[model samples]
Target: MKQETFGRFEVGSCSRSTELQEERELIQNPNLNPGSSSLSSVVNECKKRRPINFCQEEEEERSLKKRRIVQDTTIPEWLVNVMMREEINGYDPKLILAKKLYKSDIDKVQSRLSLPSNQVVTSDFLSEEESRVIYEQSVLKNRTEGLSVVLVDPLLKKHVVDLRKWKMGGNWNYVFVDGWNQVVSTNTFKVGNVYHVWSFRSGGGKLCFALVPPRNSSDSGHGGSSSGLSSR
Candidate 1:
């Protein structure tokens, strides 16, 4: 009998016979394949450790873009002023002023103001009619003291004319009331008309004046109609 050494395993004459018999048995049994179990386990571990796919990454990016767009909307300042003026006057001064200043040419006027096209058409701040009113009120206020008066309406077209202009037969008038009140009376020169009067009293003091149209008649009543009162 011969002895042999094969890698880590040694076969002596007595053990060689037993080893040979064992090797022959293993060859006949197909189930005894070497490393097959370990190879199968390695393959399953690799499958479980695979990387993520591409579609999920794109979905996250799209969601972020949508959120950013929603956060960027805002309103302008000029429109805010127009809204406030309208609230104070109870009329759309912006619209009336726009008409007077632009003479019904809204597009030309908007271009001059350098307003955006979308703003001119869709802004809630001021319409063409409201802009016209504000413009007239501003012009009148600048021209003369007590000559131009703004009514509660922001719209200048619906303005209550000063009584002084009418008293001078110039379509309006200026009359002085107590320091706390003023009257726009059409009754003085025109005979029969309603009085549009405004009165104010505050911590400062009482200040009042009257607006009357100019009169052509010789009936010059002086006591009730006097010079404009100084605001104290």
Candidate 2:
């Protein structure tokens, strides 16, 4: 029904209807409401502004932690010279060196280890490249080839052993044990294990060395794990 006193659009104008709908929408949407503040809007804004990923940050932190592991396995050059000089100058170096077993240290040399009468030499006998460094020392280098030198035990002066430079193969730079099998048998060395060698006597025709067994796996932190190895 039309009001006789009003114009054609006076009943319900489009502008009036649109203004009412706008008020309803503002009331229904909390984010658009001018009368209240929304925490969700603040959170969305923060999320949009920040492009950072917490998971990536965590991973990088973990990687940095892992990289902190001390990597000082190989002995320094100066220390090698000190050990050699201690032997040559009659000071008799007194230090314990640890070495992890490699395939070359045990597997490839199983035959040499088992031979009761045959002598074998290895740079592996000394700690931290000591065997190689000793060979380069003037005392042993200047001596005639195949000259046997007694290595007296540091802990036990009476415990005397003999060693020499054996030039069979592999660049002719190796510490040859005149009685290697005997030493291995005496120490009960097993493959896939780390061993310790100590030096004491070098001058006076004696060079002393001692063998020590690994306390546990953790102590073999020097690396070159000897696991999954066979004597064959």
Evaluate all candidate structures by whole-model CA lDDT and list the values in order. 0.30, 0.39
Q: Write the per-residue lDDT of candidate 1 for residues 132-220, one digit (tens) a residue.
A: 44445434544232322333211111233231211233322122212212211211222232122222212232221122212222232
Please give the TM-score that candidate 1 achieves against the real structure. 0.16
Which digits, one per residue and each the tens of the lDDT, describe model 2 over residues 1-232? 3222232223222344445555565677746744344534443443443334455889999887666422222333322432345334433444334544444444335322211112222223344444444455424565444324433221112222334434444334334344543444333345565554445444663454544333333333222132311111
Residue 37's lDDT within candidate 2 is: 43
Q: TM-score of each candidate?
A: 0.16, 0.32
- Which stretches of candidate 2 lie above 4 Å from their native place? 1-93, 102-174, 202-205, 216-232
Residue 19 miss distance in model 1 (angstroms):
37
